[model samples]
Target: MGIYGALSTAVTGLRAQSFALENVSGNIANSQTIGFKRIDTDFVDLIPDAAPKRQTSGSVLAQAHSTNNVQGDVKGAATETYMAINGNGFFVVEPRAGQADGSATFSGANFYTRRGDFELDKSGYLVNGAGYYLKGLPIDAATQNISGSVPQVLQVSNAFLPAQQTTRVNYELNLPQLPKTPKYQASQSSGSELLSATDFMTLTPDQAATTTGAATTAGAATSSLASAGETLTIQIGATSRTYTFNSGGSTTMPAIDISDTSTDTIGEVLAAIQADLVTAGATGATVGLDGTGKIAITAGNATDTITVTDGTSGTSATGFNLANGTTDPTVATSTALAARVATVTADQTDDFLNQSVSGGAITVYSSNGAPAQIQMRWAKVNSTENGGAERWNLFVLTNGNATGSGTAWTRMGGDYTFGADGSPSPAIDHTDLPNLTVNGVLVGDIRLQHGAHGLTQFADPNGTAEVTTIKQNGYPAGEFVSVAVNDSGRVVVSYNNGQQLEVAQVVTANFNAVNQLKRMDGGLFAATSESGEPILDNGGGVIGSSLEASNTDISEEFTKLIVTQQAYAAGTKIVSTADEMLQQALNMLR
Candidate 1:
């Protein structure tokens, strides 16, 4: 290993430098390529085993080192279908084997790539710029879930989507406590605000639901001269307010002042008590002595149950025959309408509009893809301020074009009541609208799902129903218009009918030894024994509407280019020196 050995080593050095130059050139050329992983040359020494004293410097060999694991800068793209991998992973793809009947056919072999310049091809297949088709799991539109684990070449079908009938409607709305309708006048005290119970004749008035107290017999007797302060408590539903008997009627709730229990007649005291009850949010309450001189109290709204408690002074309520520890027996239920008219007739349309305020409206689809717009209105029947349970009735316009005796608006069901806290008393989570037909189109019976606490009756400044959310699970027939990939790696296909349906889920594959993968054309890779099998679900993430820049750095590649050139020249100089030495040896021999 003398002159020849030196010459052979110099030649190997030149070869390794050339390989490095080639890698640098390739890296610089594809510096702007999308998702391109640059290749770098690695030098390996080929050393021969020898004794310690006779050891020689080793020859060099160049091997390709991949930068597959290195990440590139991600940039936004105009195309929605274009995507990028944010971290360690490769998009599962397949190459088109050939064309059959003017359609692309794929070979079943799997290839992986970071290149994501994907766009919907003419055949509805998502293909990248390099002609590799993307593979993913198909999603069921009905269930909105991925169907299978195995991924295949995804092809969005342009076929017309069949119509879906509306099965359920999700409704969330807040009804105004005081619905100011057209008939309402702020100046008027009574009958200005529409009352649905009396206006629509929906519920029958209870004839015998009165609770009577014992007689206040010959009450000219002077019961103490109002020295000890006493209070009377009246509770309606869950709300309670206390009334204090004061010498002067001046308190937060306008306290009742029977100046002198002896001078003030029993009727005057009872009248003042009735005024206090009305001030405390009792609607249409009748409190007076009957023909037998017994005190009587009746709630106007048949649904409301009332309870009256006497004060601890034992003089205030006990004088009116209301026992100290007894609750007056009252009716707890409102009787259903004896002659209930389920819907408002065409002639009653004007009356209904003046009585009820607009709830909201939504366009729903029928079984045959027919579209119909249904308008809703709410009529508050009874109010706590009016001595009744806060109640309302819902109605939907069924036929706007109906004439003569046709039904204009149909009531949904019985009255919906609210508690003192504005939440529905019965918790109307869902209700069935039997045979719901809108504008002559049969929409079938659909369930109006309110969920938990969906409907609320709260005081609104605008005095109008505020609808928050209204949506239905129905769509008319749609034609595929475009396709895009979402952030979650799901392929969404848009239709001409303004509906976007999820069709497929994009899948990525990971490798244990990513750099050991076999590189192919178009930035693709094939699995090798060293790279191991593809891991399907461990990808970092799929970024939609973006493209990953090439990992190659142009400035770095230029610097390497200069170094390779200098090394090649040095190797040539070493070869030239070896040649000159050989020439000298020949001359000496001569």
Candidate 2:
């Protein structure tokens, strides 16, 4: 019986030694394995027989011994703590699939894991080397809001992709200040007055000279007493002309008869006078009979004279008047000519060259070489139905006169209809207007708008319509420049604005009882039923800019290794001692 007892004890010792040796070998083999926990073996003593002590009281027991069985301790492999996750979440894990849905769904069940080593696949999904995707809630592309709940299985190959670069840019500029033209005034009257020539007259003489005392024709002066003076007689008529002079110096004419045939008519006499005037070198003279039948002559010079004569007869009498008219007005006089008032029609095609709405003035430049001026008074209004409205007035001015005023600019053109709801359609084609020119150069102003929410402005001097694109240069294609994380645990990748999206995110997983996690060869754990569902959190939260290092502590592992080796050695010694005792008992039995 002693021999059998010794042999049974030795068998137990050997089993214990083998278990301890296996644990030591596992510890050493997986020293470099990630998440590996060291194992240990334990022993328990067998109870002595209580019935014998009660039944045979006071009888000395020949052999009092206890049997033991080897039992291994199944402690949690390691005491290392997970550095991340305190508050509201767990690291989410995704499954790898041969094919993935566009909506990021998976056909196989999602298996939670603690492996965070991740990189981006060529398709931009956050993936591990095995191509498993990390899962999270879907987000809207434009608004960037979470769209839906996280799917049960997030495939690594189906993660959401972000835009590579900016799509547009916006700009606004402040308009330059300008002077305002006055309004047109129509009631003012303003204008100036200029001097013009009308007629001329002429004069003429009748005879040379005449003597009072003359001799009678044909008969000698019959001793008419020439008292102290010689008496002369002259014949002075046509038919039988004669003149007698008395001694007292008085003249008497003989009874001479003028022949009717020798007398000239008024017409003939006028013709003769005109002929004599022309022969005497008179110019600009007219001869005519007035109401009294007397011949009158008008000439350019006041002091000139005219002589007349018949063709075959003696000299005829000539008479006239002479005068000159005033000078004519000069042709080069200057009067108040009205200034040219140009009229231009406003068109929809006019470019919004320069629109300045500041300092109570609005100046709009048109293609007609002048800027239209409007005085604006802006008012703010609140309305739920309609957005808002602004009133404007256009003024016309010319030479300090306001020709037109208070014209409403309700719309850019009549074709543009404004809705009562305060929304306006695209009515005006601004590009059609000539380029806004300042000092003969094209320029524009920045435009700004304010709403109930906030204010935004653009700096678009070149008038570029689209305002969103951002371009980056001088970077390598695959180099990573920056990284960012959002509120939803999704990691964003930046690659010098170039080709590479190195790694979107590194997915994490959690468990209910992390101690129950099955350790894999690497420092990773496979999920089991004891571990709860993974709570997904973003990389932005507690794990920002941080990396999870291996949990193996070299000092503690070395200590555990030494303890395991000693325990194995002790178990071997127990087996050897039990074998020797059995051999001794067997020899005594022999």
TM-score of each: 0.77, 0.38
How does model 2 fare in lDDT? 0.32
lDDT of 1 by residue, 285-317 (tens): 666666676656555555444666655333443
Task: Give the per-residue lDDT of model 2 (tens digit) for 155-226.
Answer: 232332332221111211221111111211124221000000001111232121211222222122123212
lDDT (Cα, 0-100) at 150 in candidate 1: 91
Model 2, runs deviating above 4 Å:
1-90, 95-106, 129-131, 152-488, 493-509, 519-527, 532-545
Total clashes, candidate 1? 3
TM-score for candidate 1, please give it: 0.77
lDDT of each: 0.78, 0.32
User: Which parts of model 1 have CA positions greater than 4 angstroms off?
Assistant: 187-191, 196-341
* Reference-based TM-score, model 2: 0.38
